[model samples]
Target: MTGHHLAVGAVLRRGKDILLISDPPDWALPGGSVEPGEPLLTKVTQETGFTSVLPERLLWVARYPAAGVEYEMLGFEVTGVGPHDGSGSWVPLPEAVDRLGRMWFAPIRDPAVAYLTGRARVATLWTWTDLNEAPVTHPHVAPA
Candidate 1:
């Protein structure tokens, strides 16, 4: 669909800390929209300044609707993080979960937690509904 936007995010870790960028009152992953024909690793490196990264797996795929567009966000488990250029903070996993749970796209919180905690067996599919209050999750939503 023309109204759909594709984004890629990395679950970058340093021991027990996860990388998160400040999105004003909320925090988000260190990645951005993926351009056609561009490598996913390139986007992660550009946003996070991690020149050396190894993508472990795809963690989650979420369809989040905002303002009339649907964002198809793909989260990946990336390892081998080298030096960072001070772009984002390395927060503890628990703290990062708390911060992400309160973000605008709150639906991402649970899936991210599941993956980080070694509870996820496969990449999850999520549908997010914004009810003007807080976003809610509908897991394994069927594709249209």
Candidate 2:
């Protein structure tokens, strides 16, 4: 893990539906890399086309290594957005969880499910290996 970058993601929710983007065969959250002096909300809105965004809370932090780069990914629970521009799919929470589970990114799946299901009271940390086939290791759970 020689290279490092900071990224931010949003778990956009409208009622029970979660906003997901189809990047080829995988489903992903609507977010991108956070630049210096740029707000997380601004980055999320730019990626998702949601004009009004209210970041509810920081849900999770993931240390994922891929392609020889270590990524510090942050997931936030966001709300108060209007209709999207059809750049992504709005699926029900259950289906969203199922889709996320099948993808290689366990960081997005675990925290989203935990927070939405009322299981996660505080932000959790997840560490993932570089290999796509390898499973996540040492998942951190917040104390009750």
Candidate 3:
């Protein structure tokens, strides 16, 4: 059986902008893996240093292969968050596509813009063969 890397991320929004974590030159959502008996939202807060409300529904699911391992990233629509301490900052929605250029992974960035801006209605799925290649988007994909 092939090993799989499963992770959950929150698309925290503030008005016309969204939250992004600066992980040493890389930008991404505030989230992490699902520990045994531990919730996804809890992991998000721990990793990103931001408090977030439970998402109303799943937003997206992305899959890609790298170094012989299959990676799966789940995205959720976090309704809100508590005060942040500058660890991570917010970026405008309209400018996110340009600002996130090469600074973050596409799987996370694309869905965040789509969902936050109301382009998608439900959980989507994405897959790609190469990290540099564009991902195939399937919006509102049903859960497996």
User: Model 2 off-target regions past 4 Å?
Assistant: 1-3, 114-119, 129-144
Give per-residue CA lDDT, model 1, range 42-125, as digits (tens): 777877877667889888887777878878888888874677787789999989977887775544655676666655545777
Clashing pairs for predicted structure model 1, backbone only? none
How many residue pairs clash in all the candidates, one count each? Answer: 0, 0, 0
lDDT of 3 by residue, 40-61 (tens): 6787777556565667678888
Lowest lDDT sum, 10 consecutive residues, model 2, at 135-144
lDDT (0-100) at residue 102 of candidate 2?
Answer: 74
lDDT of 2 by residue, 41-71 (tens): 6777876777767888887887878788888
Which 10 consecutive residues of model 1 have the lowest summed lDDT? Answer: 135-144
Q: What is residue 51's positional error in candidate 2, in angstroms?
A: 1.4
At residue 141, candidate 1 shows an lDDT of 29
CA RMSD of all predictions? 4.5, 3.7, 4.4
Deviation (Å) of 20 in candidate 1: 1.3
- In terms of lDDT, model 1 sits at 0.73
lDDT of 3 at 55: 79
